[model samples]
Target: MSKKKSFPLRLDPELYEILQKWAADDFRSVNSHIEFLLREAAKKAGRLKKSQE
Candidate 1:
């Protein structure tokens, strides 16, 4: 694993609830779900280049 950093995150109430439910359904932590979403979105948006910081 690379060096890890922690940052405060803010989420919309409704959106966060949905993400929480989906994450539970998939048996993944909310953090993992968010990471998956970011990876996929980056791929689709053509921003997967330049090392996935």
Candidate 2:
């Protein structure tokens, strides 16, 4: 497994609420859902490196 980096994130209250609802709908924690979205976006842009899994 790769080491994961952590950082502080600030979101507008309304946006956070939306993300919470979406995450719940997808059966994912907000953090996982955000990472999923980011990974998908990176893949779509051809910017994701091949994983070592």
lDDT of each: 0.89, 0.89
Model 2 accuracy (lDDT, Cα): 0.89
What TM-score does each of the candidates earn? 0.76, 0.86
Q: Tell me model 1's lDDT, rounded to 2 decimals.
A: 0.89
Tens digits of lDDT, candidate 1, 1-53: 88766788999999999999999999999998998888899889998886874
Stretches > 4 Å off in candidate 2: none
lDDT of 2 by residue, 1-53 (tens): 67889999999999999999999999999999998888899988888888711
Tell me the lDDT of model 1 at 51.
Answer: 80
Per-residue error at 16 for model 2, in Å?
0.6
